[model samples]
Target: MRKVVFHKLCAELRSRALLEETFHVTIEEQVAMFIHVVGHNWSNRPIAFEFMRSGETVSRYFNLVLDALCILARDLVCIKSIDTHQQITSSHGRFHPYFQGCIGALDGTHIPACVPMHMQDRFRGRKKFPSQNVLAAVDFDLRFLYVLAGWEGSAHDSYVLQDALSRTNGLKIPEGKYFLADAGYAARPGVLPPYRGTRYHLKEYKGTREPENPKELFNLRHSSLRTTIERAFGALKNRFRIFKCQPFFPLKTQVKIVMACCALHNWIIEDGPNVYVYDDAAWYEALPRSVRNHTDMHQENLAWAKKRDDTAKMMWEDKVGQTVP
Candidate 1:
């Protein structure tokens, strides 16, 4: 800065300004990421000093960015760009590529957070740590359709969806049109979750009895659709390694960073072909069937638990509103 001062920095500033202007995503997209994902430890004195021309710039600009992401997520309808096709088959075989008739896969991920002293207990979840459970829904092409935030870690995945659906009525998929999800979600008309038991690609088996006839067939069909989401999540965490780390910030900051990483994921997938492929075979081969079965049974079951679980869900659903599409 001392050597180059205004002249050289001005040119770089102009380039940065121009870059920001061209994207269709509003300034919120820029700001949210600037704070949450791109600028972690931004408040640390020396680190802040390194990035900002002035010390106060980060704080001054932080809320400005936060407001923008909020607006972008609420108002913008993202139109996907995918090449869909259909194959010629007289009767039996058909193959082509498009969005692959896959709408989206919904999942919940817990982000570690610095919970407030007063409410820390409310946020402690499965791992016995303070965290925030964020629920996001994405299309088969791995683009985010909707993201709902502010869910407590202890809350069930089904509860998260119910809250999002009730709060945002527009998200209701039309009749017979469904978004695929793991068994963690509730079973309703427009949301199709996998059937319990048995196996399919990326499916984790729970101890519940294997699904009967048509349900098994439905899961088989849905597996092809849902894999995209898993792949998308894997790519996202891999690229933004910090997201994989336990969040040790305020709950509010956790939300901001989560959204930022998601935007970053979309940005990369849209701009390039760096989508990640998971080593599911490696993970599966290393894990025993009994362990996999035990893990799957627990994690994939937010909808129907055992007798204790089922009863809890019944009570929880009453408190957590249900929206039928």
Candidate 2:
């Protein structure tokens, strides 16, 4: 985080009465300690030593700042607007009309978690170690629209999304608008996923291996646009060191930390300096989309599937017409 953005966050916290400066420790120091801990993944003892304060003091202020950030998240992590995003509007017919109703993309990520041995079975899944399945939505600009963390690693992505939608204040998809999701999610009314058993990932269309049919063409374009969420997750895990290892905090605190980090990520992006490094290409290479469990039998709706087919046919027809001699 930049110095200007740090001060801004502290000022915002104070303005909202989320935090106050004590005689022994100023709000700035308290926030700095919290940032150091999350940014460096330092434990209470080491953070206390670096801040020249007792371990108890470090832990107290860390939680205080964390609570404040969580409150701030309600404002930061949200949709910029309900209007059509400029990225799609300015796509020069690439995605303008076809995906104009797309508000953003949603995906689930596994954040390493530390749990007791007795409950490890429930937490262990695709990853070797236990983790939490965190679902997040991101717009074209890489800002987080919504986040739902704390689900066990063994939970399926579609199940987590269903839980999120069931919540009162969970992700809201306005009428006529939807989000692009990977095949891990069901093709519901407000959710769109690429066709299965088709060339979906962008890497599949490299070099001269262009999309051959309407399904492949639509999948190619869908994958290209849906990368926004992937990039958001990439930038997030890249910036915060805490995600690199399993946090020793309780399961509840671990979940709160994920939410706080996402909020802080948005704050730094919007209010702070724009020093965020995008691992667009590198992140894709690290985790090939082909390996994802797209083969899973999701409860795809017929209406949504027909909508996808219509969009793919339109896109393919346009491509064919433009290439005519």
lDDT of all predictions: 0.51, 0.85
User: Judged by TM-score, which candidate is best?
Assistant: 2
The residue-by-residue lDDT of candidate 1 on 169-230, one tens digit each, is: 33444332346678776555446666566455534335654433433434544566577667
TM-score of each: 0.59, 0.90
Candidate 2 TM-score, true structure as reference: 0.90
Query: Model 2, residue 119: what's the lDDT?
Result: 82
Question: Which predicted model would earn the best lDDT?
Answer: 2
Could you tally the backbone clashes for each prediction? 4, 0
TM-score of 1: 0.59
Question: Which segments of candidate 1 are over 4 A away from where they belong?
Answer: 1-43, 52-54, 75-102, 200-218, 245-250, 272-325
In Å, residue 162's CA in model 1 sits off its true spot by 0.6
- Write model 2 residue lDDT over 1-325, tens digit each, in one string: 8788899888888878999999999999999999888888888888878879999999999999999989888777766565678888888658878997898999999999998899888889899999999999988889898999999999999999988876667776766778999988768767999988888888788899988899998998899899999999999998889999999999999999999999999888788533333223232122111333434323336677888889999999999999998
Alpha-carbon deviation at 109 in model 2, angstroms:
0.2
